[model samples]
Target: MTAPDPAGEAAAALGADRALRAAARHSAGRLTALSVSSVAAAGAALAEPALLGHTLDLLLRQDPAGARWTGWCAAVIAAEVLLDAATARLTGGVDARSTARLRRLGLGRLLRTAPHHAARHSPGELSARLTTHATAAGGVPAAAVSAAVALLPPLGGLVALFLVDVWTALAFLAGLPLLAILLRTFARASGASVSRYQEVQLAMAGRLVEVLAGARTIAAAGTAEREQARVLERLPELGAEGRRTWRIYGATMARTSALMPLLLYVVLGVGGIRLAAGALGVGGLLAAVRYAGLAAGVGAVTGRLAAVVRGRSAARRTAVLFGLPELAQGDARLPEDGPGTLELRGVRVVRAGTVLLHDIDLRVPGGTTAAVVGRSGSGKTTLAAVAGRLTACDGGRVLLDGVPLEDLSAEELRREVGHAFERPALFGEDVAAAIAFGGGPPPGAPAVRAAARAAGADDFVRRLPRGYGTALRDAPVSGGELQRLGLARAFCRAGRLLVLDDAMSSLDTLTAREVERALLRDVRPGTRLVIAHRVSSAARADLVVWLDAGRVRATGTHTELWRDPAYRAVFGDAADPDREAAGRARAEPSSRPDPGAVLPSVPEPPGREAVR
Candidate 1:
């Protein structure tokens, strides 16, 4: 195995730090308030012991001024309590705002990245990063401020000790080295454990998400128990890590708990000696002991430091999303009324050192349909993706209407190009909203119905309880119905170019043919790049581009390619029966029309004209 790159690791750590700083800055105002309040609270806490001791001394001497000192002591205590409350409030605000900022940044990057790049992270992993990891990262600003402010009480108490009695102060100073050693050790060990714990949590979360997505499959296969075992494969590791973190924390607190009282007692003993020598008063000795206790309260500091360490580790995980390379959009726009002519020059795509598509050159003129036919893994989907700039070509360039895809602004590119996937995701409030969802202003109700009709989705949609207004979650659509909605969505925004990547695979042949007919006659006319598996789809296209392996093997009319047995074998047994009939007709040349001829049209589905 190759050795790890130390330089790359260091750079990633640095990037994580920078991401954390940016998140902190997003809530700078509230963090500043939290810091100020924390410092003020620490100051008040430090002053309390001295004020109470003075009041006690005055009361013992029968001084009338003792009442005033007690009142002042109460006021100081009240101020400390109020300041701490304010700090808590400020910390909440900072955390909320910072978390929101981190989530927005991460989500924006996820959405802006090319689809293939974004798929590098699993849905569960992405969800964990944006939710739990973002929450932890967001708390960093408050934690850092509080940790810094936590130093004030200890340092002030040390100074206050000296002012009370030099001997007591020196006694407290003697134990400072031990406290420093404890904090350093806790920080180092706790950080490693926390990081390991978070990593395990992320792994489990990713597995759980995978299981959820495949729950139905697992249930059907009667592998629920097996899948559950797989999902929780790391549960023991997670538990171990959790125990390790707590053990470190418990160990550090136990050490601090043991050391603090010893130091306090040493100061107390020294104060007693001073009192015996007439060098310290009872009130002064009392103050000295309190100061020493305050100075040795390293446990509070350790807890705060632990928060900082955990936040830093979580920040690293959350920062990964921000590192995704976004698909950059240029400032240029397409020419007005330009035909959706698409041209690919030496287009190539590679992932994990394996070529998915390579050296592909093709052009489809505006107002035509081109079907990409290939066996499994033949680069058809990749070609469809490249056509609409869903994924950038690694080797060459793709142009739409003479403008390089990379040169078009995001708004311009999305507005001019559309896509429907085999399993398209429907996103919106209801059925109508989902159909109308696309770049630019949403299509109005009439346009939505027309598009739905063209995709043969109107009849079923109208049969629903609330028709177009039905909630998506409430509309129990099948796979084919879902595909129709996706096609409808694409049709509603059909522009200069539309890419359908096996978008009709789930539909029955009758519905698929009807949708195809409407696509040609009723939908907005544009260039269509269809990634097809069924022979009928290829036959209906104006042109067919056959892919073999990662290269374009042939480009012609489906009829022309049909004469080649190798080309016919691509569809295998799944070839349409009509295509078989056409093939038989071709074999008996004198009996029937050419096999390449368009199949006879079927009657339009009923109620198709109502939507029109």
Candidate 2:
């Protein structure tokens, strides 16, 4: 037999303790009841074999009390059955309750964490952690209780054997060390394999989720087979780990299956010899044989240990989600009713050692619109994210209405700043609900309709089967229509600061222009930060902030920057020789504000170009 491993045993003990603590925290009463019932059931079961032996012996001797012994044996058997049933019921309840608590806690933490931080884990991995891992962790309490109960039969068997014949009991105990070594080996070996298997499983699941989300892109690229291969690339690793775990378990069971029965036969042989020598009576011999079987059935304990190891492995994954750091919030609240004057002071953001934005200092005055324009990768989106506090800057600060953004509570921030994304996650129950989903109180029907009209979305929405009451999933709205609904939702809440991150990308030129005009006319007067890709969008803004390579290249009205060749190149002109002539003709300096200029009426000169 192999020597005992103190380190392995210690780790197993620690894992069991952690599982127990989690269970106790979530389902203390249920766990306690389960443990109690399981113990009682095991105790009653342990007494049955001995009582049967005694009853049989009494019948053989033709004793008058043999009938009473038989009756007592029957009573013990019935009690064991009832106790076992209660144990099963309590065990399931405890597992379910603990699993639910873990899932809830994990999901809550995920939702509250910052988007960039939450992005560290993929959607598939997070889903698995909440589902598969949670279910496995929930079984920990039941396994612990079952493991405790499994000890009783063997202990009782050993005592009964010793009382019947000392040599038989000694023979039974001689094989126990081998069983212990086998269990420890399997527990240690299978743990690593199981952990690896779960990781690979999540990797594949994450890949699948990404593929499904981008199915249209894959189809357009005509790479369905290639994508399928990419998704299954980790399948071999997963299978290898799964096979390794099963092999270890099977080997342990095989060795135990061989050794435990041998130990039982040895005890039986010893009891038979003692009986022949008249050192033990027939009833005692019978009792010794039954006790030997119970003592050597160590397979039950092996199964329980396997369950414990599985639970511990799953708990580690769940812990990662639960332990994620939630975005911090302050105790202060925004002051009552002020224009949203946004200021960014020396803001910098670095992700994975790549600078997304650097030394950004800008201010958007209340009631004015500022368009952030840049080529793809030029930090426009990052700036919008920082301005909205969707992600906190690595350095410096952003303030709204003279209060640092970090000083405001979550509720205050949400109530004061609103965002509309290019691809909005519209997951409300119905069309109207989707249009009034975030930040502020739900708007009444008139307000919802007005916001939709402002976004140029009312015509299409009213054509849906149930109009406002149509389920969002069943509405089958186009991408542009969906973006409009998201815009309406953002407008309905109408925070002090509104950020549009390419929110109008899907709309046609006419629809976008109408929506922009309506935004200027109908929305509450507040600060606007628009991340623009088109020259038309920049032309509509009161001021334009031009970003190049994570730094602010220039800031002024669009007409002023239009003369710079590089700035014109942002709208895809290499060098416009006539730009200087155009600037001289306008005779408008970049510094002066053109208060009378309304964007839609601004004439685009021939060869000067418009946003394509």
Candidate 3:
């Protein structure tokens, strides 16, 4: 979900061939209508000069053709006006619909991708893709159709001039190569400029979004100016690229403006000579002059080309989101009575040529809690993610209840595996709604309330202004409360395997213990994987997995592992006195052995003390 290679994007937009083809597929009908109308209008416009010339001839000769030709000219003008109106309506509709479709598609892809892949994209970048890029690219169909139709007027005028006088047509044709060269140069320069402008704009926008999201931090640190400077670091590049685009546009227009009149004047002079030499009539001369003007006017085509260039640049950015690869899923279903046993075989995760998890082989029995403990960057979270199937490992086979996690259908996987994160995205109409946001048959009111209670969120919910009806956006809750609400949401889904990745990090000891008890008692029996940073959480778990530097260093009951100096050091425990104090704090009135208690020695495995 990261931004695509700049070179690849440039290739995609260089000719805008791919974007044009996509636009045609999505809005071909509207584009075709616009093109047909443009052609009709151009034809009507081409007839104007010839008809007026004929009228002038009739007036000079005192013939009746004048009235009829004048009336025909008025009809053609009326038809041209109507066609233009239709073209405008169609263009507006195409632009709106295509932009909407692009936004919807981009968001859908972002949501459906793996969490790790999605993290590679920033909110600001995605927002730019959904809005600015989509809107700009939406104009591609109109610009392409207009550019195609623009050629008709000049070509038709040249034909009419040739029929009237060969010398004038030849004179108009002679100046075309210069205009072509100018347009080609403008396109190449403007395309590169527009592409760079969009890139810089995206960078600035992304930085701004991040700053806005962290406004409280910046204000607390009193670094408003510093943050602002950082956010605007790319402003100069954006401005330079923007100005370059305009400069190219202006230069193209200036050259066309200077050349157009000279071309027309030369053709007119040739037409006058033909008339004076008895090779052409006065009416023929008039028609030739008008045709020369039409043939030389390159303004409309230039505008359409500019639009095409901008639209292509934007479309390339939008296309990156559309082309992101989706995680693969299968259609197999889990057995109804399957135990939620989790296993990882030869699990390896390599990112940017660095191993995050190496040859991880671990398993958790169904109906037990396994706490994965490690220092920072020790791959505990990665293990939790892989176990829950949130992300697939590079070289591994993960089986949930004897079924390969990847072999399960998406719906089945989501329904069978649940996850609670450290910081959850809880956006809903109200508190109750936020806690019930997940798959599986929608939780009933009773189920929602029960889940909230199980996660220790009920007391805070009742204190809110509207209780469960209070809007999440309006409620001013603390970090612990927010974490509990996220936990409640996860609890609502009756998944067979639940992964809590530092989900209760913000909770106090008593509250976390209560939630843990509630989870064990209320929820259906299932496997639980807890990524823990606290020694107390590991002490409460059925088994502890100690990971060091992307490899599992030890696995056993917390009581068994506590004897190791390395294991004690994971919790920053060193001296015997500090260990005793921590043990006293964790030792509550429970049947389980106290942290400091000397329990009877159990048989320890020979190699690395693995209990699995």
Candidate 4:
């Protein structure tokens, strides 16, 4: 399946407010523990300063209470400072474990998604989500809980002030509405900008990966400058967005700064006049000012809360990244460990409205060799593919040892049948490893040497710096050499069915003939299917099957087909001029052979393919 739309992914990450809440719940126990300590610390911190103010006020008037208040103030200050440090440490530890659990769940979901889901997204984009997004989301518990914790002490202080003087509490309450407006404006506006910045960060990561991967292509095309320009252009846009977020945050903070001091001035100025006029005591005025200072920390908490909301946006994006799955549903059935006879029953392959192979009913009976012959486009390769089950047939069943191919698991089929194509692809591993790649060396040196010798690669491989042990990077091997190694790997597989899909096409005719002879001489007596262009190679097989326009036009020994006009028409008249002369050389009898022996008595056309 193609990837779900990017918009859906973006929407999911952005809309996972529920996931964020769920994560919070997971962290709740820890958060509560930390909050308890944090609130206690905050109360201690507030108490010491209040006591200090009391001690100073008493000292100024030389009251006897001054001596008692001084000792209490000194002791309380030390305990409050120690508790605040301890709570901060506790909060840090709890957040670490919560982030780790969230990471595991998100990553596990992604691993379950299908392979096509992975193919649709870039490695860079996925990495960005895991790294950048996960990092942001991981802080959710601490930020949300810390804001609440920080707000508590100030709230408690405000209540104390309310009890001391109603007019001072009223003055502080007046600033609350304006302060709220500023924080709301900052959070709303900056939320969008921070989200934008997070997106750009992901894009930048993706772009960096792309640039590194395509460095060679970019250099060859002289496109480095253009790519640099594109990156440069995007950077400023991100920078500008970041600036906007900062300004909004700063604006919110500015209002809190202005309001805190204004409340203090209004309370002190009014309370001083009231005290002088005998409406309140000097001690009460001092306490009211100290409480007002404690309330000011609310602004910092509000700013942190806003940043946390934005960080969570990143976390949600990363979680979606971890949700994508890789790969498809593979076949699950197993092979019976019996005859690996491969058969294509009335199969036709069609592509782009053109028939590639039609009604190709061919079989490689167990412990037999069969060859498919045709022109370049006459379906020789396609017939070989059907027998190997590399490409699926559009019509009819391909059976392995009488079992339908699809019913057998892919691993089972591969285990039973192996193929060597005209072109072979090797991984970035070294030469010796690629040769042994179909699996490890075939149990012993004899098996590995025989397989390599059969492919005519053992000689050249031995001449390399370290022979079979040579690293691929240390020596240069041509494509033809790689093809030989691929064949060696296929031979080493030792499956019941071996398929050579024009595998010898890369070698010269002499070398190809040498390899062919060695293959027949050494490979196990398994059912073999050879797709060949040269008639001589096809003639070596026990049965020769000819494909023309996706159909089996002829099937017989080479000499028998030489006399048939349809076969003659396709391959041209035998150039030997003397049928007897060629017959004597081949030592094949000049009598009509049993047709049913080599092929299933030429399939009739009325059903699917018309026998000529």
Worst 10 residues of 3 by lDDT: 603-612
RMSD per model, one decimal: 4.7, 6.5, 5.4, 9.2
RMSD of model 2 against the true structure: 6.5
Summarize candidate 3's per-residue lDDT along 1-612 as a digit string, tens digits.
266677875666553455446556777687777778888888888998898888888889989878888898789889989988988888897788667766677677777777787777778988898899889888887777788888887878888999989998998899899899999999999988998899888888888899999999999999999999999888888889888899999999999999999888899899889998999988899999988877875656999999988988888888777666676789999999776878788899987689999898777766667889989999988888888778888998889878999899999999989999999889679999898887656778888898898899999899999999998778999999999999998888757789999999999877887888888777666777899877767877776888999998878777778778888889886345435534854464333322222221112111111110
Task: Please identify which of the two predictions, 3 or 4, would achieve the higher TM-score against the true structure.
Answer: 3
lDDT: worst 10-residue window of model 2 = 603-612
In Å, residue 281's CA in model 3 sits off its true spot by: 3.7
Runs of candidate 2 with Cα error greater than 4 angstroms are: 1-20, 61-64, 573-612
**Pairs with steric clashes in candidate 1:** none
lDDT score for residue 523 of model 1: 80
Candidate 3 stretches with Cα past 4 Å from truth are 1-20, 574-612
Ranking by TM-score: 1, 3, 2, 4
Which number leads on lDDT? 1
**What is the C-alpha local distance difference test score of each model?**
0.85, 0.81, 0.81, 0.71
- Give per-residue CA lDDT, model 1, range 384-450, as digits (tens): 8888887788899999988999999999999889999999899999999999998788789999999
Better model by TM-score: candidate 2 vs candidate 3: 3
lDDT for model 1 comes to 0.85
Task: Please provide, for model 2 over 448-521, each residue's C-alpha lDDT reduced to its tens digit, 9 standing for 90 to 100.
Answer: 88889888889999999999999977899789998999898888777789999999999877788788888887
Number of clashes recorded per candidate: 0, 0, 0, 13
